[model samples]
Target: MNLTLKIWRQKGPQDKGKMVEYKVTDISEHMSFLEMMDVLNEQLTNKGGEPVAFDHDCREGICGMCSMYINGEAHGPDRGVTTCQLHMRMFKDGDTITIEPFRAKAFPVIKDLVVDRSSFDRIQQAGGFISVNTSGNTQDANAIPIDKHAADEAMDAATCIGCGACVASCKNSSAMLFVGAKVSQYALLPQGQIEATDRVKNMVAQMDLEGFGNCTNTGACEVECPKGISLENIARMNREFFSASIKG
Candidate 1:
């Protein structure tokens, strides 16, 4: 298949960026989006031109490193999949796919299709760690059996890979979905109860400090999240936050 790609080109964070166009031919429908990108890069290299720069670690979608805004949608036109998991068949021949990095004040572009996502790291770091009873008097981990439903939900929440799709998809650039998933993963389980109050407070504080916008209940984050992280997690996080606020 032949396609035209209008990709953002930026030399550095401080450099002015613009959309640059190119053409690719004979792309297989089975090729994962990243593979198609590799083909584009190869073509550029063969012509002595700088190739597009995008992030991808573990193309299997486990890492969530392949962040791209394709044709105005986070992770392209697919549902419940990361950019690396997107396939060429999602589009057709003679298609013009516009690709850019995830855009948010918190996610500034570092270069072409690569953004500074260390902000997410800082938000996560602000959550700190869960308290564990490692003392000699510790009970067996399996002794305090968690409810099956809560445990399952907690595990689901833990599936979040820290991808910024929530932020990118939000009109307000809110990260509530991501933060909600992080908080809920622990909030649902007994092991996470000890630091629940501080966990929610500190993480929310850090989220605000990072310049991420507030959630307006638009539900765009859940719609774009590759992991299918639910909006219910956001509601649970709000409850956790309010409860923490009340206690203090």
Candidate 2:
């Protein structure tokens, strides 16, 4: 297959950026999106032109580092799939593909298609963890009898890989889905309830300070999420936050 790629290029956050076009020919449909980009970059490098810069690790879709906006979609036209897992077969021959970095105020561009996502780490640091003593083996695996339903829900919430697709897909650039997933992961676990009140308060406060928008129930985030994390998590988070606010 052949493709025309219109990709965003920028030297840095302060630098002016624009969409630059390039043609890629003879691309295999079996190749992953990142692999297709690799072919394009190889051709550009051979021509003495600077190659496009994008992030990718563990291309099997586990790492959540392959971030890109393709053809105006967060991770291309596919649902519940990340860029790294996106196959070239999804596009037809002679297709014009537009690729851009994840856009958000909190995720400023570093260069080309790469954006800094440390804001997510900062949010996690805010209160995404439990303060358990690591001094010794204190509890057995079954010490806390977690309900099967809660355990399953917690595991589903924990599947979030922090890819930032939620923010990119949201018109408001809200991180509510990401934050909600974190909140739900802990809210359902017995070990996490110890500091649930403070956890919700601190994390939500930090999310606000990071300039992320409020959830507007547009459901774009849920649709674009590679993990299919539901808006129900956001609902759960709202409840947790309200309860935390009242208790505190």
Candidate 3:
């Protein structure tokens, strides 16, 4: 298939970026979106042009590094998959694909489709972990019995890959869903109970400090999330926060 791609190009953080058009031919339908991009970059390199810079580590979709806003969607037109998992079959032969970086105040454009996502790391660092003794003396985690339902929910919430799709898809670019998922994964287990109060408070504070907007409550985040993290996690986080405030 022959395709026209209008991709965003920025030389540096302070550079003014714009969409540059390029075309590729003989693209296979089974080729992953990133693979198609590799083709484009190869074409550019062969013609004495600079390759388009995009973030991609594990093309297997687990690393969450393949971030792109394709045709106005977070990870192209596909559902429940990252850009690395997206395939060329989703587009027609004559399609014009518009690829850009995930847009959010906290995620400033670094270069092309790469954006600064260290804000997520900062939020996680705030309080996303449990206080546990992990020296030579380690107790079996299974010793503490957990409710089956809570265990399942916690495991599910823990699947979040910190992809900014939730933030990019949200109208207000809220990190509530991401924060809620992180909080729920810990809050549902007994090991996390010790820091429950401080965890939620600090994580939420850090999320706000990173310039993420308020939750729009439109449920766009869940829709765009690759892991299908439930909105119930957000509600649970709210309850945890309220309970923590009351206890204080």
List residue ranges in candidate 3 displaced over 4 A: none
Residues forming the 10-long window of minimal summed lDDT in candidate 2 = 132-141
Q: Which lDDT values do the candidates have, in the order given?
A: 0.94, 0.94, 0.93
Query: Pairing residues by index, what is the TM-score of model 3?
Result: 0.98
Per-residue CA lDDT of model 1 for 32-114, tens digit only, reads 99999999999999999998999999999899898999999999999999999999999999999999899999999999999
- Score candidate 2 by TM-score against the native: 0.98
For candidate 2, the per-residue lDDT at 67 reads 93
Q: What is the lDDT of candidate 1?
A: 0.94
All candidates' TM-scores? 0.97, 0.98, 0.98
Clashes of each: 0, 0, 0
Among residues 3 or more apart in sequence or in different chains, the pairs in candidate 3 whose N, CA or C atoms overlap within 3 Å are none
Deviation of model 3 at 162, angstroms: 0.5
Q: Candidate 2, after superposition: displacement of residue 176 in Å?
A: 0.2
The residue-by-residue lDDT of candidate 2 on 93-112, one tens digit each, is 99999999999999999999
